[model samples]
Target: MNVGIVAAGPVHDIPDLKKVNHIDYWIGVDEGANVLYESGIQADLLTGDFDSIEPNRLESIKQNTKAINQFSSIKDETDLELAFLEAIKLKPTTVYIYGATGGRLDHAWVNVQLLTMFAEKHLDAWMVNSQNEMTVKYPGKYELNKDLSYPYISFLPLSEVVNGLTLQGFRYTLEDQDINQGSSLTISNEWSEKKGTYFFNSGILLVIKSRD
Candidate 1:
């Protein structure tokens, strides 16, 4: 099963929700509930402080969703994080997060960090928008299949350094290399074959597959 979580980020950055409506479960946060409501989509869980959402839309979401987790505006975590917490509880095989990027850089950064946290729990999660998809991988090997929709692949060290990093079947292959966080050593590489393989021994790495 897969769960899709949508937040209250800029609507222009979100991809077509209709394409992901088939997910087994859906989570909406703050004005993201409004997005689902307007799109005629139903969410399994609705969570947020509801500060950014209109009362009518919020009420509609509360009525349509299986449950609503209302939090105060003064809560510790962001509305999106709360919805993510609810989504992870379902233990979906994969979690797709939308409306999480392309607004405030701080919020986007935190949401990207959330992917690393979920990765630590062995959850397959990704933060996606119209033009980009962000994935965090722990210390392990990963296979990325070739996709024309997203041709450029970049790797960024999530920690101070990612050690023993190896890449195969890519335009720029690496063998037992160490990538530092601030280094742009592995960026804008394309798969030379049908698939590319990457493995790292320690530290988390952010794998971004994107295009203009």
Candidate 2:
């Protein structure tokens, strides 16, 4: 099953939920419930502290949502983390996260780090917004198709180094290279054909598909 998690970020940064395919369940976090409800998508579960959400909206969400998992405002987990824990119970194949980026810098960066947990679980997880789709991958071979909506692709090392990095069918290709953290060597690449491939022998890689 595929699941989507929507968090409280800039409303405009959230993609049109209806347009994403194969989303079997939707999890709304905090004010994201209002965004989902306003977008005409009822959430399967709502998990958050409710501090950022208006009381009236929370009431409406409670009425329409399938279930609720409310947390204390003083809890250890952030609202999004709570929502993610809820999502894990469903055993989804892939998780698409919306409204997670374009917020406070710290929140956004931490959310990016959260993708590593998904990677550890061997589940596909993406942090998506209007102009970007981000994911983390382990050492392996992977393929990508050209996406007109997100015309650029990038890879960065999440670890100190990603060894034996290679690229095929990309405008700026590499072969058997080592990319260190903080290196801008793999930024802003484009597909040279209908599809492209990337591979690395070791370390975690941060991949981003984006547009201007």
Candidate 3:
């Protein structure tokens, strides 16, 4: 299964819901349901405390969705977490998350951490917005297509250290370089050739590719 989760962030920054053609399931987090409804997309499940949505809207959502998992406002996990757990339970081949960025810094950071959690489970996931796509990767070789149109590429170490970092077809190549977390060594590298490749031997890294 391939699932898509919509969070209650900036709806305008999200890609057009109509463009997503192969979503097996749709999940709405809180007021995100309203965004989906406005975009003429139906949700398979809805999860959140309904704090951000008006009572009438929430009632309409409850009537429209197949399943609703309402939680207390003082729950332990965030709405995104709850939606992620449900998506994982479905064992999806890929989980595409929208409306996860361009909001509060704390929420954005937490959403990034959620990507790490999916990576730890050996799942393919991405936090995608209008301008950028973000994902975490374990130490390994990664090949990126040249025609993707993302102008800038960045690799950020998620652990204290990422060892044996190497890059090919990039403006700034690093061969067997060790990058420490919080270091600005791996930032804003563009492809110098047709294809770009990155490899690492240890630690997790967050790869971000952006168009603008």
lDDT scores of the candidates, listed in order: 0.87, 0.90, 0.88
What is the clash count of model 1? Answer: 0
- Ten contiguous residues minimizing lDDT sum, candidate 1: 52-61
Best-fitting candidate, scored by lDDT: 2
Tens digit of per-residue lDDT, candidate 3, span 135-195: 8988788887664667888999988899999999988999999999999988888888888
When sorted by TM-score, best at the front, the candidate numbers are 1, 2, 3
> If both were scored by TM-score, which would come out higher, candidate 1 or candidate 3?
1
Regions of model 2 farther than 4 Å from truth:
none
Better of 1 and 3 by lDDT: 3
**Model 1 TM:** 0.96
- Total clashing pairs for each candidate: 0, 0, 0
* Candidate 2 residue-wise lDDT at 208: 99
Which residue pairs clash in candidate 1? none
Which residue runs of candidate 1 sit more than 4 Å off their true CA positions?
Answer: none
| Candidate 3 segments whose C-alpha is farther than 4 A from its true place | 192-195
Highest TM-score, which number? 1
Q: Name the lDDT value of residue 15 in candidate 1.
A: 90
